[model samples]
Target chain A: MAFEFEYSAKNPLYPVSYLKLRAMHSRLEIIWTGQAENQAQGLAQRVEQEMLAMEREFNRFSEKSPLAVLNLKAAMEDVSVGEDLFMALELSEAFRRGTRGYFDIATSTSCGKDMVSYTLNPKSHSVRFNAPEVTLDLGGFAKGFALERVSRMLSDEGVERALLNFGSSSISALGTHPYGEWWAVGVDHTKQHGIVAKEVRLKDSAMSVSGRNYKGEYHIVNPHTGASVAAEELILVEGRSALVCEVLSTALYAAPKTEREAIVSQYDGYRASEILCGDCGSVSIRKIG
Target chain B: MNRKEFLSDCGKIGFAGVTLSLFPWLQSCSDKAKQEVKGEKARIGIIGTGSRGCFHIKHLVQMPNVEVVALCDNYRPHLEDAAQYYPKAKLYDDYRHLLEQRDVEGVIIATPLYLHAPMTLDALSAGKRVFCEKSMGYTLDECLEVYNKRKETNGVLFIGQQRLFDPKYIKAMSMIHEGKIGDVVGVRNYWYRNNNWRRDVPSPELERHINWRLYSEYSRGLMTELACHQLQNGSWALGMLPEQVMGSGHLVHWLKEDKRDVYDCVSAIFTYPNGVNMTFESIISNKHFGMGEQILGTNGTIDLVTGMYYSDEPAPKGSGMHQLIAQIESGVMSNSVFAGTSWAAESSPLAPGVPIMTNVKVVTGESTVGAEADGSRELLEAFIHATITGRQPEKVLEESYYATQFALLADKAMHENQILRLDEKYKIPYTPLK
Candidate 1:
C-alpha cells in the first residue's frame, strides 16, 4: 500500500519541496517550505504512512478492507465498527442531513435497498440494516476525511507552510505559500487542457470541486433519482474544513442552480462558485454564495 | 514425403482445417522430419547497428539456429560499439554491401524509419528473407511499394511485430475470440513518459540523423513508433482494420528551446467497420498514466500489457458460514444467529481483474527479461524457422501491411486535422496462411 513518490526540486534558492504520489486512482501532491530537509522528509514519511493506513482501512476495492467487511455484513446484524469508520459514518449522516439529503452515503447505485433501511446506533457504536439489501459506500467523502486528518496531523507536528492536494479534487492548505501571499490554486476548466477557469486563494481554507461531465461520462450519481446527474457544470466549494467543502461541492453540483445557494448558506464562512457550460458551447462562471 | 510436400498437399485442402485436424500428425512428424525440413542454420545480417539493432543482436546471438554473420551501420561509432559484441562478424559501411554477402540467408532491418521500406525491398529482391522492425515504412507509398515487392518475390518477408507471438497475447486473443469478454466495444491505449525524447548529440551536424525520431523527415514520432503496436493489437483482436481515423496533436510542452518538429502529445480515435472505436494517446510531458492498452468489451475488459482480464460481473459473495465467522471476528455476534435476510449484494460495482494466462509466472526487476524476451525472441525464432524451412506464414505480411497503413493514415489524420477514410486501394489483398 506504500504509494510511489516522485520528487522534484521546485527551486534552487528557497529549495522548495514537492512530492507526488498516486492514491485512490488519482494523483496526490504535497508541497511545502520553511522546514529543513530532514524535517520535511520526516513529515513526508508520516504523511505517506497515514495516507496508506487510511487507504487500507477505507478502500472499498480491497476484499479484506474494513470498509468492505462493514459493507458486506452491516445489514444483517449490528456490526461492531472501528472508531474511524464510526466517525466517518457519523460525519456522513450529518452531511447528508445538512445538505438536505443531497450528500448521501447509503444511497449508492450499488445499494439495491432504500437508505432508510439502514440505521446507525451511536450508543452501541454499531451499524445495522433494517433490510437485507441495504449497503453503505463512503467513496464520496473518504478522500476529504483522509485529507483533513493528515492536515491536522501535519499541523500538530509543527509543519506550518504546506499544501495537501488530494487528486486535484479535494485540497487543504496549512498556511500561506512561501513564494506567494496565499496558496494560489487553479480550478481546471472542464473541457480545456491547462486552462484555469478560476483561481482561489487559500490561507487556511479547504476547497473541493465536483463536476458531473468531463472526460467520458458523469460518474457522480444523484442520490434522489438513483441516476447520474446530467449537468455539465463544475461546482467549487471553500470552507473552514475539508469535509464540509467536499460535501457541499458534490451536493451543489447535483442540486439545481436555484437550490445551490441555500445549501451553501447553511454553513458559516463557506462559499460556492459554479462554472456552467451552456448548450451552445459557451461557458460562464458565477459565485452562488 | 518431405515436410514441404506434405505441407503443400495439406495446404490444398484448407490450411486452417488441415492445421487443426492434422495437429497430432504434425506433432508425430518426428525430429528427423524437422531436421530434413530445416536443412541449414539461418545466417542473419543486421542493418543499422544502433540501440534497436544491438537489442536484436543480443537476442539473435542467443538463438540456437540463428548466426549473426554481419553488422552494418553508416555511423562508425555505432558500428564499433556493435563490433565489440560480434568480433567475428563482418562489418559494412553500407547496407547494400551487407545484402551482397552470399552467406547471409536473412537480414534484420533495425534502421531508422526512413530506411525501413528501401532496405526491406532491397533485401527481399536480393533473395534474402527479411525481418524489418516496425512502422514498416516511412510513408504510405513506401509501405505499399514494399508490400508489392514482397508479394512479387518468393522470399519470406516478416515485420517485427513481437506482440503477435507473445504467449499472454495469444491466450488473451484466443479467449476474446471465444467470447470470453463478449464482443469488443472499444479499445483505449496510452503511452506516457517524462523525458526530452532526445539522445545526446555527438555534434550539431549529426543531430537530425542521430535523433531521427524527433524529425518530420525521418519519422512520424509517436504514431509510427508507439501507436503502431497498439493499433495492430486493435486490428488483430477485432479481425478487421479501422475504416477511418480522426485525431489532434500538438507540440505543446517541448516548445521553448527544443528544435523537435514532432508533437509532444497526440491522441486519435480509429473507427472500425463495425463502428467500434479504438482510441490512442501518447504524451511526453507527464508519465503519470504510464503505458497500457485497455481492451473494453461488453462483458469484461482486458489490460493487454498486464495480461489481466477484468469481468463486468462482480466476485461471488461469501457463504453464510463465512459471513458468520467474519461477523464474529469483528465481535459483532458470537452465538448462533437466526436466519437473517441475505443482505449480500449480488455484484460489486468494481472490477477485480484476473490473469488471463495464470501459468506464466511474472518476473519483476531490471534483470528479469522473461516477458520482453518471450515476445521478441519468439518473433525472431519464427523468422529463422521460416527462413530455414522455406515457409513463412502469409498472415505476418498481411498484418504488417494493414497495421502500417492504419498507423500512417492516423498520422495523416492528425496533421490534416480531418477524418481520413481508409481507401480500398491501400488495402493489400492477400489471404492469410493459417
Candidate 2:
C-alpha cells in the first residue's frame, strides 16, 4: 500500500561506515556522528529514554518503590550501609582503584557523607538508599555511564556505526563516523580561548576530560590530602567505556606520577591525558593508554 | 470527620477533586477549556511587490488581525499595483528606503534571493520584523550572516517556508512527535516535477533568470528552492541535525549544464544524532508527481506530505465534495470554466470519496501555523505576553537556529558534494537573516 509520506534513507547507502549523534549535553557542545541508519533514530530515542529511565530508577526519594524497601531493609542491619548500589558501588570501587583513593566513591568528604555511609541496596533494575547524611553524587561519572548505556542501547537497536556524546566531554564514538578513521574530537586547551591542545579521532571507544582548567578550583576534591585534587586544573582521560574514563580522569589527576598508570590500568579499556599547571610557564600533554 | 474520613471523601469529590479526576489520563490528556483573548493584529509590509508579493499582500489582507501597510519594489508597475490594491499603504523602489519608513512595522521580502540578506539585515537594523522568502539567501555564508544578524540584533526574522505554514506538514509533525508511528527510523522528503530546465520559446538568454530555480547563481537549484523547505520539515520534526550531507545528481534530459548550473535529479541524505537518516530527492524529468516526507519510526511509518500539488492537507472528509459541488454548481450557473462537467462523474453525497491519510490533523498559515513562518507575529504576541505575565512559548531563537543550521548544512553538502562538518559551535557565524 502507498504510505501517506515517504520514509527515505540517505548516505546513498554506503557499504559500511558509522552513525553519529550529538547534543548540548556536556559542558562542551557534543557531536555523535556515526554510520548505520538502519537503527539511528530508534537508537537515539532509546538512548534518551534510558538515560532518563536510569535517573528515575535510582532516585532515592520514592518511598513506595523497591529501592526504598531495599534501602530500609539494608539500613536495618547497619545505620550506614552500602549493600547493593550496583552502578554506584562499582563506580566507587573503580574510583578507589583508579584514584588510589583521592576520588573515592566510598569515602565522604565535606560535600556529603561517604559511600560506606550511603545506606543503600540494589536488586538488579532497582536501587535504594536510606535518608543519607552523605548525598550520593553520581555527577562525576553518571553522565559517562549514561553515555555508555546509550552506546549499548544504540547497539541493541542494531545501529553499528554511531557516535553518541552525553555532554561535550563525555562521549562514546561507537563506529567510524563515515571518515573511515576515528572520529576527530578536539580537546580545548585550558589556558586560552579557542585553543586546541589536541584532536584525537577515536573508534570503538569513548573519551572524557574532567579538568579544572576553565571552571577553576571547582569540581576536584582530593581525598588523600583532604584537599582539592583537580581544583587547580584539568585532569582528563579517555577509555573504552564511560566509567573508566570518569574514574581514571579523576584518580590519575591527583595521584603521584609513579602510581597513576598502575592505578588506572585496573579498568578494562582506558587511556588518559593530563595537562597540569607548571612553574616554568610550560604546560604538558600526558597520554596514558 | 476524621483525617482518613476527610481524605476518603476527597477522593469522591467533584470541583474539589477535579484534579483527582484527571489522574488516570494525566500524562496524555487534551483540554478544550481554552480561553481565547483577542490580541493585537500583526503589522506587515511587502517588499518587491511582484506577483508573489501581491499574492502575499492579498493573503495577509484576508487574514484576521493582520494589516499589510507598505509595498516596496524596484519596478514601478508593482509599486503602482500596491497603491491600487492598498490605497493607504506606503510604497518604495529600494527596499533600503522602505526600511527607513516608520509607517510599516514589519516587512515581507519577496525579492530575489540575493537581495534577501541585505534587505533583511537593513530591516532588522532599522528595528523592524521580517518575513523573507525561501533559499533565504544565495550562499551558506549569506544565510548564516542574515540569521546571525537577527540573533545579534534580537530582531524578528522569519523565513517564508510556506510548508511550515501549511497544515499538512504541521499535522504530520505533531503525529511524529506523539510517537504515533513509534521512534521514527527514517524520513524522506522528495519533490518531482516533469519539466525540462529549458525555455518554452528557446530564449536561453533571459529564460535562466526568470525561472531562477533553473540556475545556481540565483539559486541552489532543487535543494535550495524545493528540498530546503522539505529538509527543514524532516530535520525539525526528528529533533536532530545532520552531521554530514552529500548530493548526487545529473542533467538527465534537461537543458545543457554549460549555461545552467542546476540539477534535475538531486538527492541528499541528512543523518541525525541517533542515526535517524533523512533523505531529500528532487527529480524534474518525471510527472508521476511526488513531494512529501516519508517518516519511518518503530511503530508504523508516518508520511508528512507537504508543499506540493497532491500534498495539500487531506481535505476534510465529505466536506470536500460538498464544497466542491457547491463551487461546481456556482461555476456552472456563473459560467466560468471552459471544461464542461458533463463528462465528469457526479460527486456523490451518499458515497463520497475516501478521506486521505495524515499523521496529526493540523492547520497551516502564519497565524494558524508556526513562528518560523511569521516570527514577530507569533513571537511578539508571546513575548509581550511573557513580559507582562512571565510566560512564553516553549521554543525560541535557539530552536530556529537549529532548523536554520540544519538546512544550511545539508545545502552545503549538496553544493560541495562532500561531508560538511558542523562540529564547532556557531562555527560559520555570519550576519543574521532577521
Candidate 3:
C-alpha cells in the first residue's frame, strides 16, 4: 500500500486543502483541512495502522498472516478476537437482519467474509473462526467507519480541518475550511439528467451517494429479488454523520414508497434528495428533511 | 421498567434482557402444535400516545392477539389517554425510555416531527415494529435511516398514510388502471381546503416543536402534509413517480415567520416518465374548487373527486370503417377494377363523415359519468390486510420506497425550479441520470 495527498476543490466553497489518499487493490482517500488538518493526518496514520492490523487478522490473500492460524484453531475449535472486530461482527449480524439481508457484507466477490465468521477472545487481540468462507469486504463501509473513528480521534487530537473519503462512496468532513461553516456539495438530479440540484452547505457532516447510477449505470442490485431498485438513479443525502448516510442510501434504494419518506426522516441531522428515472425517460426528484 | 414488561422479561430472558422486547412466542402455550405453527401477535407500543395515539390505540385494542403494552409521552396528560387503555402498561415521560420495554413488539409513533428519527431508531434497535405518521421526519437522512432501519429489521412497518388506506383513492387508481378513462396521458391533483388548521400558542418553544405540522420543522409544509398524499395518488394512478418537480410556494393568508417555516400555498407541476404531467395545487388562502385527480387519457378523463369515469362512448358505429367502404363503392373507377381512382368522388372533402375521433362526442357520457366503486376501500383494505397478514402486499416496500423516493424528487424539482434527474446519490459527487 502507498500513501498520497493533495488539495483539489472546484465548488469554490473550499480553497487549497489537503487530501490523504492510499492505493491498494482498492482506493482510500482521507481529505482534511481547517484547524485540525495536522492532527487529522496523525489520525489518518492511526487509521492506517488499524487497517493494517485488521488486514493481518482477516486478509486471506496474505499467506504470511496469522489468519490461517486463527482459522486452523477454530477448526480444532479454538480462537479469539478484539473488541473492534467483535463489535463489527455483532454489527454485521444486526445489519444483515436490519436490511432484511440487503447491504450484505458477506456477499462480495473478493475480500468478503463468506467463508469464516469471526469469534471473540474477550481479552486478547487474537481472532479465530470456524473456517474461511470468502474474503471479508470492508469495501462497503467498514473502512469508512474506521475512518469515522479516526476522524473522531483527530477531533480529540484537535485536527480542525478534517475530511476523509473511504474508497467505496463514503466521505467524512470535520470542522469546515478556515473560511466557511459548511462544505459546498453539488449533485446531479436523477430526472432532469445533467441538471444540478440544490447546493448543500454543511459542516461536520458526512454525505454518501450510493451507486444506483454511476457513469449512468446502476451497480446496486436489490438483494431481495435479484433486481435493481426500479427507478432510483441517484440519491443525495446530507446529515450529521456518514454512518447514517452509508446505511441509509443502501436501504432507501430498496425501500417501498409508503415508507420511503418516513424512513428517511428516521435519522438525525440527515436529509435526502432522490432522483428516479423510469422507462419513459422522465425523471422525478424528491427532497426529504 | 413497567410492571407488565418487568414480569414478562423476568419470566423469559431474565433481568438483563428485560430491556429488550419479548417475542410473543415466549408466551405460555396450551397445545404443542400451537407452539410450532402459530405466529406471534403484532405487539405495539405508542409514543406520544395522545390524540393520534389514542386513535391508533383504539385500533390495536380491537385487533385480536395483539397488545398495546407500553405508552410514552413527555407530557403526563398525553400519557393519560393511553394509560386509560392499558392501565397496567408501562408509562414513560422520556420517549426513549419506552425503547427498553421487553413486551413491546411494535410502535405507533405520532410525536412531534423533530423527534421522529431519534425515537424511530431507538424503537427499531429495541426490536419493536413501528408505524410513523406522515411526512416521516425532519430531514432526508432521518427518513432514509428509518427506511433503512425498517428494512434492516424486516419488521412490519406502516406509515400513517390514511389516503393509502382510504377507499376513495383505491377506486380512482383502479379505474385509471383499468383504462376506464382511456389510456391515461395527463393528470391534475388539487387539495385546497379553506382552513389551514388553527392552533393556540401554549408557549414560545412549544410553537416550534408542538403542533409542528403547521411549521417546517415537523412537516414539509403543505407540500408534505397535503400535496404529498395527492402526489402519491397521482403516481399510483399514472404508474410512475415524478422526475423533476418545479413549483412556487407562497404564504399569502397566514404569515408568521417566527412560528412557521412553511409556505401556506404550493402550485407545482411534476413531469412523469411517459411524458404525462401532473399539475398539483394547494392553497390555504382560499380553496376554490377541491381535491382530486383529473386523469387525462386518450378516451376520456377520470375525475377522482366525484368518483366518476367518463369517455366519449366509442366513436359512432361504422362512422370510421363505414367511410372506407363507402369511398371504395363510389370511386370514379378506371376501366378495370384494379385501376386507379380519382380523389374527386370521395365522401365530402370539405366535410367528411364524422371525421374519425374528431366526430366522436367530446362529451360521450353525461356530465357526471361513472359512480364511486369500492376500489379505494379495497386498496385501503389491501394495505391494512397486508399489515395484518404479514404477507407482502401489492405495493410492497420496494414499491412504496420508490414513491417516497419520488416525493423527495418533487421537492428538489420545486427547489431547483428546473427539470431535475430522479436518481440522485446522497452526497458522493454525482453525474446525473440523463
Q: Whole-model Cα lDDT per candidate?
A: 0.73, 0.52, 0.53
Residue B346's lDDT in candidate 3:
18
Interface RMSD for candidate 2 relative to the native interface? 29.9
**Candidate 2 lDDT over residue span A26-127, tens digit each:** 221122323344444444455555554555545454564333444455434432223324656556655664455656643343433233334223433333
Each predicted complex: what DockQ?
0.02, 0.00, 0.00
- Output candidate 1 Cα RMSD: 19.9
Least accurate 10 contiguous residues by lDDT in model 2 chain A: A1-10
Segments in model 2 whose C-alpha atoms lie over 4 Å from true places = A1-289, B1-42, B165-167, B196-209, B256-258, B306-404, B423-434
Question: Can you write out model 1's per-residue Cα lDDT over A181-230, one digit (the tens) per residue?
Answer: 66666665555533556777788888888885224367777777778887
RMSD of 3: 34.4
In the range B295-361, model 1's lDDT, one tens digit per residue, is: 8888899888777888888564332223323332343422211111011222434424678755442
- Candidate 2 or 1, higher lDDT: 1
Task: Give Cα distance to truth, residue A128, candidate 3, Å.
Answer: 99
Best by DockQ: 1
Per-residue CA lDDT of candidate 3, range A1-289, in tens?
Answer: 4554443333233323343345323345554433234544555567677666766644545665454444445444545555665566566645555545555544432223232244445566444444444334444545546656667866776666655555434556777634445544444344443344444554788766664433345556554554666654556566776766776776666655555577676565678767554543455668754
TM-score of each: 0.56, 0.43, 0.43
